[model samples]
Target: MAAAAAMHISTEFINLKPNIWKKPDRASGSCCLGSDDISRKRKLPILLFDVMDTIVRDPFYHDVPAFFGMPMKELLECKHPMAWIEFEKGLIDEEELARKFFIDGRDFDLEGLKDCMRSGYSYLDGMQELLHTLAADDFEIHAFTNYPIWYNIIEDKLKLSAYLSWTFCSCISGKRKPDPDFYLEVVGHLGVEPCDCIFIDDRPTNVKCAIEIGMGGLCFQNAESLAKDLSHLGIDLSVPNI
Candidate 1:
């Protein structure tokens, strides 16, 4: 009976048998199944992508120091993390942070720094292409990032705004990654079930959190590998080069 039911339903909608294993309580009017099963059954839309180190390379490690006329070693030695932390908490304005990092006592031109951050930041190869392809296919693409100051700048400069439907940043949202609250807030704000969204991040902890919230997640390595992996999930990746 279970096999028959499983075969009858569309795999895209739900890939399980209803009442084959166990029936739900009369009050609920639905069988109790795992989130994975429920998500497939419900057929939700939405793909959540992590920004830093996933779509774009680590900007701080590569973009910031070089643009600010400081060596990577010097920038790393400076206590920027605490400032960033405060910025993420909404205690400091993004513009203020940028001013502190790139303007105050910095010999580099502010406009040049902005330009470098905008255009010089390297994105994962084929990422823009893949995202465009996905969006063209009617998949809603959202970017979730920990970086607050440069999110809009990078997106605008890279021409990613066209492909990305919306962007969620910890700086703007006042929520950091790897925290269930951040993911929950996003899912709730988007009015989608956790299972309906597929989250990709470079960090395992974030992926684990997504999974725990009943969302599909993949740990990203590179654009080529991620494209291949998404293929298994029925997402085609024939986007044109950006």
Candidate 2:
């Protein structure tokens, strides 16, 4: 099994595929860098960004029950904390919960609910410009999020599909952040060593998890503060003010 796994990775590294989401002519280069090749080749730094509170302010209004035509205060006052606990554990789907609470309650319009959710979502200041700067510098930027198909909703609402090289969501992979295996899976998929990647997340535990797996990690506070921190780490983030 180990040998087969090695062979699979070897194939992925050798037969680099194209970035289907990007331009048809552009190729997804191998993520591996050998000792000899590392010296000769310009090592492209990979930046893994967290979604939600890291890149965007997670507005509470979006999750409010009132948006779904339910009593917000009443739902909050309910003593069933286990429901939220189960939700966080991925035992319950967000859409399904919304349907059970709101859609089945009355004349709930799915499109309207989506629009309200999107309207409450706001981008972090300077994020768009930061992304452009990183892309211009030839750095490979990707997103790692716990959000499920909700990433699709964010992509459509923010129109950020073009700025990112790829996005990995736990919903798609059946894996959650702060897990060593989750980070390892991403490294395996990218065909890169842990040392070649840098991950930025808002949560300290998540950052610590990445570090435990041998990847460089950054704890994000704000975009401005993060830019200063990245600059100290030799990353040139000279983008115009957003």
Model 1: residues >4 Å from true position, as ranges? Answer: 1-43, 68-71, 98-112, 239-242
The superposed Cα distance between candidate 1 and the true structure at residue 217, in angstroms, equals 0.8
Error of 1 at 55 (Å): 2.1
Report model 2's TM-score to 2 decimal places.
0.71
Question: Model 1 reaches what TM-score against the true structure?
Answer: 0.71
CA-only RMSD, every prediction: 11.9, 12.0
Q: What is each predicted model's overall lDDT from 0 to 1?
A: 0.64, 0.62
Q: Over the stretch 1-242, how does candidate 2's per-residue lDDT look in tens digits?
A: 01111222233223222111111111234334544454245444578888777887665433646654445455444324333333333567766544443322433565775676677677788887887778777777888866645566778778766677445776666667776888999888876677677788876667777877767778777778778767776685876774
lDDT (tens digit, per residue) of candidate 1 on 1-242: 01111223333423211111112342453422345455445433577888777877655566667765678656645534455665655668756655554323344365765676666566788887788778778777888766656576776667667877546877778778777899989887776566557788876666767877777778787788778767766665765552
lDDT of 2 at 184: 94
Best by TM-score: 1
For the record, the alpha-carbon RMSD of candidate 1 to the native fold, in angstroms, is: 11.9
Alpha-carbon lDDT of model 1: 0.64
Extract clashing residue pairs from model 2: none
Using Cα atoms with residue i matched to residue i, what is each candidate's TM-score against the true structure?
A: 0.71, 0.71
